[model samples]
Target: MVFLLFSAATSFAKTPLQPILPLLEAMPSDLHVTVPYLLSFVMADPLKMAMVSIENNLSPPETLQKLSESLTSLLPLLSQLADIIPRDALLWKLKLLKSGAAYANSRLHAVQAEVLFLASGKDNLLPSGEEADRLFKGLKNCRVRYFKENGHTLLLEDGVNLLSVIKGANMYRRGRQRDFVTDYLPPTLSEFKKTFDEDHKLFHLALSPVMMSTLTNGKIVRGLAGVPDQGPVLFVGYHALMGIELSPLYEEFLREKNTIVRGMAHPMLFGSKYETSRQESSRLDTVSMYGGLPVTPINMYRLFERNQYVLLYPGGAREALHRKVCLMSPYLY
Candidate 1:
């Protein structure tokens, strides 16, 4: 098992080892541990909790009755496990969890390597959040991502998208170093559908914007017919009122022009503060997936060099939130 795990870690082309809850489930399935603990740890009242989860859109409709039925089914299997496994074996496993971290703490500082610590806020089984902070302080190159509502088994839970987390952290790269432009991943068809149909569905319907373009002769035309049918185009516009204009602008180009606007976005959108409280899916993720790069001179240059359509907001927050001055002034700031 150790060899296989090591091989799996090394096979990924120098990706660092991620040790998450090592030996977490190695306990022998004795009735004392499995029967009572498993039942209470997850579902004290399976049917009731299931109903609550369903009502909150956390689980499917069928989960209510089905979960209760599943719990009943677990009894016989747990009984079988109690008979098969020794009680002392289970007790020793329990002992390990109590002392495992303390044992590892002294040795951890000796190992100098990059670490990504994922802390679960509601982890019932362990003090994950506190441990993560401790590890972050001790380790040289450690970064932490906290999942406040998640448990120890967050990977198997619903709405936990790992790729999105990695992307939001700006940790996606092909080589040793990072390159924002070359490393950016465009939104897939599924992502596009989700963003339009699910995320911004209401906004798209409410606005139903009318797009128009003008020619060099000052002749106006309906739709994007007058717009260039090529790349390297820069669309500069006012960021009116909390950037509500962004959605339609991006969507219309996608729907009609078949273009992904590489908007030079502010760092605030991609910062850690946003990720700490974000749950399940986020519009910020959508922004990044749709080619929203950090507002920097190099990023803009890169987009133009690649012959990609670019979008920029010169005024930024000053224009979006405090628009009265921008409205009165003939010249844009």
Candidate 2:
């Protein structure tokens, strides 16, 4: 791991690493270290004390049941980790994040590698910002894949097709081997029909999604009627309410215009740095296959140069929170 140093904002007490005895006893051998590592931020000292107090207040049987319930929910979130990251080590890693100035774009530009940056949209620790964009821009050969809805632990998230993503990346380097499968491929009409039918069924069963269109001259036209049926178009829009608009909008475009909007995303969708676990590796692969590329200006420029319909949300995570200012802002580029 690369170490970057910057002046500390506040001197953290030089506390000793916490013991792993409790974690080992509480979890399985395979998950002995991984769970605590991922949950370090989540189960910070304060929160752990709170949980202990809550448990202590309960009867023995009740406490056992509560622990069981909590662990069941927490285990899944802890899935991607490969090993138990030592507390001191994890803390040191976190310090690097706190010292963000250490990983400047100028420094990143010095490295020569095919970097695939996967940024999380809901990363609480290192939230999305201009810094990611700057680093992406500075890189020589880099691709970005962003997960618009996921948190920092994308590798542990559901529905990520990791194999397809790797295949796609290799294709990028090897002149587009068309025979390989990738998550990026638009669903075939039949595939879409099956999935859409199910979604349509659910949509009608719950809150029915209504699609509106415009009238041209005298006749009603599809939403994408004016868009060229050829190459290279960009669609800019707001990310509203956890980007609820994304699915409906994509479905609408495919239904009406037969267009697939390639989205620019944060890099976390690609995977985690500590992809020690097979499960985590699998999840990142799924994200790549789904055509989720990292948010980068260069990637967008190239897509436009190649004539693809790209989807861009100027207001990213900020707008998704339903903040009025974020939603009402004129531009967020």
What TM-score fits each model?
Answer: 0.64, 0.39
Q: Pick the candidate with the highest TM-score.
A: 1
Q: Pick the lDDT winner.
A: 1
Q: What is the C-alpha lDDT of each candidate?
A: 0.60, 0.49
On the 0 to 100 scale, the lDDT of residue 219 in model 1 is: 94
Stretches of candidate 1 above 4 Å error? 1-40, 43-100, 107-116, 132-144, 214-223, 268-285, 323-333
Name every residue pair that clashes in candidate 1.
none
The residue ranges of model 2 lying beyond 4 angstroms of the native Cα positions read 1-184, 189-195, 199-205, 213-223, 274-290, 323-333
* Model 1, span 1-333: residue lDDT tens: 000000011111111211322333443433244544443454223333233323232256566566666557645654565556456655565456346645656566665544556566665555566666565566555556677766655554544556665665566677766577898877666566656776788987998878899987889988887788787888897876777877777888888988788888776666554333213335665677777877888888888998898998888766777755443322234
Q: Kindly list the per-residue Cα lDDT of model 2 for residues 1-333, writing each as its tens digit.
A: 122111111112211222533343445554445655555563222223224324234788887677667655655544434344544555556566436545442366576655555554554444432334544566555454555555544454443333334444433333332222222465555445533564344754464566554445555564656566767877777765665555566667777777767777655444343332111223234334334466778778877776777877776656656564443322332
